[model samples]
Target: MSNPNTPKEDDKVNALIEKCTPILKKMTFSSFMGYCGGLTAQKVGRGMAIVIGLAFFGLQGLAYNGLISVDWKKVQDSAVSAIDTNNDGTIDADDLKTYWSKLKTIMSNNLPDASGFSLGFFYGLTH
Candidate 1:
């Protein structure tokens, strides 16, 4: 009684559920209720964290879409401004390279998460 031309619709639904069940399991009702339960500081903190995370992700998307542009040349100019130990008006490659070498000498240097960009965009918001 097997016809290879088509499969049962129930089988297709079962396959879809099997693929999504693991992800759905993680988002349980109790976990959501816990966050919405009390009006205490704990709930406030959780809500704030969620808001901040969402805002960060949204801004990241905007930046990626070119709705916002981070001014990287400003950061670079600031870093290299003091590198001209020769008192040159222009920033030559030699002076810039020297700055890079000195920067790497620092132990435990907390560099920016991205090149010419602030970590998590706090500076982008403030400045």
Candidate 2:
């Protein structure tokens, strides 16, 4: 047997549906995909930040406890050697300029969503 209150409940449901119909119609597939992509990027960025932060802190703790020793001079020498592309035994302004140019070219060619990913990465790091 149908309840006596069914008509009133049906009226309320119909009114709610009518109110939501416009909002549903405005949501397109592209909008949905864009939102999903952005959300995925943000989540991935956050995860990367967490892993990097943890690794940094872990290394710091280990270094502080003297569990591992780092030869800073050796490290600096290695870095200088790596950056000294001209092999002139020195990292001069010209070397830095060349390095910067190469880095810019590589980044521009490789990273398509660089701006968005960097923004999301910084946001994740800060927040």
Candidate 3:
């Protein structure tokens, strides 16, 4: 007994979902990589505000995300994880210093470009 205005979880829909469950459950290489990438994006987005504030304070070195490795947790803390300027629970372009800054951060971390192999990559604190 359900109201016409309300939706019901019918067997057909459930059956369809069950049919696709196996495929979704199997994590392929692409899917696993995608999941990891998504997690990394979330981590970076959570620290967008801190990054912006750091930039304002002349800590531009934090902005450089070359191929070199750095403590992401410390970097994220600089932005203050709780500050959700975008109200999206993550520091994204909405609250970042600028759109270009956001792009730079993401690209520098995920894609090192041709310069990644160079020794200068280690020196780029703000790419």
Tell me the tens digit of each residue's lDDT in model 3 across 3-74: 776545675876787889986576444444444544565667669978877755554454464434466677
Candidate models: Cα lDDT each: 0.53, 0.65, 0.53
Worst 10 residues of 3 by lDDT: 117-126
Candidate 3 collision pairs: 45-91, 50-79, 64-125, 64-126
Candidate 3 regions exceeding 4 Å error are 1-24, 57-127
Error of 2 at 88 (Å): 22
Output the worst ten-in-a-row residue range by lDDT, candidate 2: 116-125
TM-score of 2: 0.42
Ranking by lDDT: 2, 1, 3
Off by over 4 Å in 1: 1-39, 70-127
Against the true structure, what is every candidate's RMSD? 18.5, 10.0, 18.0
lDDT digits (tens) for residues 1-127 of candidate 2: 8787665645978789889998658655434433454566578878999998897788778989999977657867997898898989789998978965664455335445544443443343344
TM-scores across all candidates? 0.25, 0.42, 0.26
Steric overlap count per candidate: 0, 0, 4
Candidate 1 per-residue lDDT over residues 82-122, each given as its tens digit: 66655675678877577545533341145332222211122
The all-Cα superposition gives candidate 3 an RMSD in Å to the true structure of: 18.0
Q: Is candidate 1 or candidate 2 better by TM-score?
A: 2
